[model samples]
Target chain A: MSKDAFFALGLLAGLMIAAWGLGRKAFKSKHYDEMQLKIRATGYRIGFFTALALMAVLMLLFELDCLGIVSPAFALLAVLMVSITVFAVYCIRHEAFLSVDGQGKRYIALFALVVLCNGLASALRLIRGEALENGRLTLSFGSPLLMTVAFLVILAALLIKTVKAGKEAAE
Target chain B: MKNLKMKAARAAKDLSQEQLAAMCDVSRQTISAIEKGDYNPSVNLCVAICKALGKTLNDLFWEE
Candidate 1:
């Protein structure tokens, strides 16, 4: 297998292991409380529409021939990441992102790891001059960067919520 | 419209939001939101909270 394929498989395996650690709490509505389920439902709705809007924008950009730098797959992946981030941030703010039995510290640690790993991968690709093809950003650069940004946003949200909850509990 | 009645009832029972939430099998944030009028809980949750606080639906959730 090619290097990229091997790396992708490894990353997929790592993510699967993390998800398994989270178990049924990883987006299973049955693991959430009633209010959390409701909030998650709204978050899903918002994510769906956000994805729809982004796809429309991508389509418009394609029609206008403005999507020259990035490949179609990168563009689609960016949209997906953005929508998922939005949903996650929304649910985090509403105190519904984590399952009822889920620990906030675990998620915070996971997101932090995601941000770090992806950020370092993107940086390494950039340094190796492997992030561009014919002066257009390639998936190697864009994918990891997008994942870093998405997870960074989620980590920030979770941190802020944790701090706020701490203060509230102190009060 | 904060649910002062529920808060008062909880206070009377010497129960904190976290304790009440634990008893109701919900998150403390859920109880806080319900008390702050930020969320109108489902009837089932209302009943659970009422039962946890040792109050009836009318005593805690009924509007004046």
Candidate 2:
């Protein structure tokens, strides 16, 4: 009935969905070595912990009535989230690269875009003195218009690179 | 980079990625990713691939 409870439930649901997808992928491609499987499993665990930590910190801030206080906890959570996301992406990229043809460029380009977006968003938040807000910090630059344009540009470049690489590989 | 060369040589010998993967105890995706220069194989993996392909490590993986 409470908002916090709803948020926690939503987070759990999202995590479950992610876990299901990852499990299916790992099962369908059972040819991975033990080490590779372990690495993949570790990545998933890291992701879950990162998400859990962020939610806990946010909830605590709300409870303490210092959600708006400019503190190190907010920065720490943001950095941890970014790091975990990057690690997860790396694992996914490795898995996809092994399983799919012509995925190299797409993965790299998407990764670059993600890094760029995170870096810029973090910097902007820090500069605008909005990094320590108790509630969610949404970004105007993360608007649909700018995101769409960046996505289109990255997709086009990835497509062109994939085609060219495919041809070269053939030769 | 050198893994790509090894993969090309293995392919020239009429080996599929799955076959090479089996020899190296890795997934076919790993082999494919290595060949495409998207993933770097460990030293152990490189040695396994070279052995499976019937080439010396240097012959398969040496780069200028």
Candidate 3:
């Protein structure tokens, strides 16, 4: 809710919109094949359940007054990011993250860029010791940190899947 | 449960998985999964593969 938080939120939204615009043509459901569509549907189902479970956990923590330093907004945002990351990783591993005609190298480049930018922002916050305020994580630090970690996890999954696919193809 | 018939048909046509997948408008992994019995293709996909390989549905997909 601070000025930094507002700026961070704005940046996050802008980045997401940019990424979505860049990926929409390559990743649209209409561009996916039947198998990819099925796999993605499964991914969505899994992500939905993951979000539900995470929300339940968050509610429980709130009831127990255990969510000490994390703001409700940040906690909710983290849950959303985690759920989206889970869906993306699952789809990527299953070879359904991209359309049949998609240029995966392009998508990988985009993901790498996202990770790099968010990681740098997070590092800046950490170095400046601005990630925390009165021993509590502020939205400014938590948002970028969460984005960096989530995208890093997705990038790792994509890379592993690509390697495995390459090996399989070679065999 | 492996689709040996489909694989044999694909091989008979001298098409690699990637080639066949391209012809069928699916990912190579999808074709690989189908042949390996790791995933089942829908009827439409079966038709597409059959058409691409110049095989009948019975020739490629019908279990003996």
lDDT of 1 at B62: 82
Please compute the TM-score of chain B alone for each predicted structure, in the order given.
0.95, 0.82, 0.96
User: Residue A57's C-alpha lDDT in candidate 3?
Assistant: 98
- Candidate 2 lDDT tens digits, A1-171: 644345346646877997897888767764556446656777677767776777677678777877554334333445455445544454554453233243456465665676577557656756876543345443322222233444444444455555655674576
Candidate 2 segments whose C-alpha is farther than 4 A from its true place: A1-31, A34-42, A45-49, A64-93, A96-171
What C-alpha lDDT, on a 0 to 100 scale, does residue A121 get in candidate 3?
Answer: 87
CAPRI accuracy category, model 1: medium
Comparing 1 and 3 by lDDT, which wins? 1
Cα lDDT tens digits, model 1, B18-42, are: 8998899888888888999988999
Task: Say which candidate scores most in TM-score.
Answer: 3
TM-score of chain A of each: 0.84, 0.38, 0.86
What is the fraction of true interface contacts found in candidate 3?
0.60
In CAPRI terms, model 2 is classed as: acceptable
- What 10-residue stretch in candidate 3 chain A is worst by lDDT? A98-107
**Local accuracy of candidate 1 as per-residue lDDT tens digits, A2-69:** 45456556667987998888767755644567878889999999999999999999999999999898
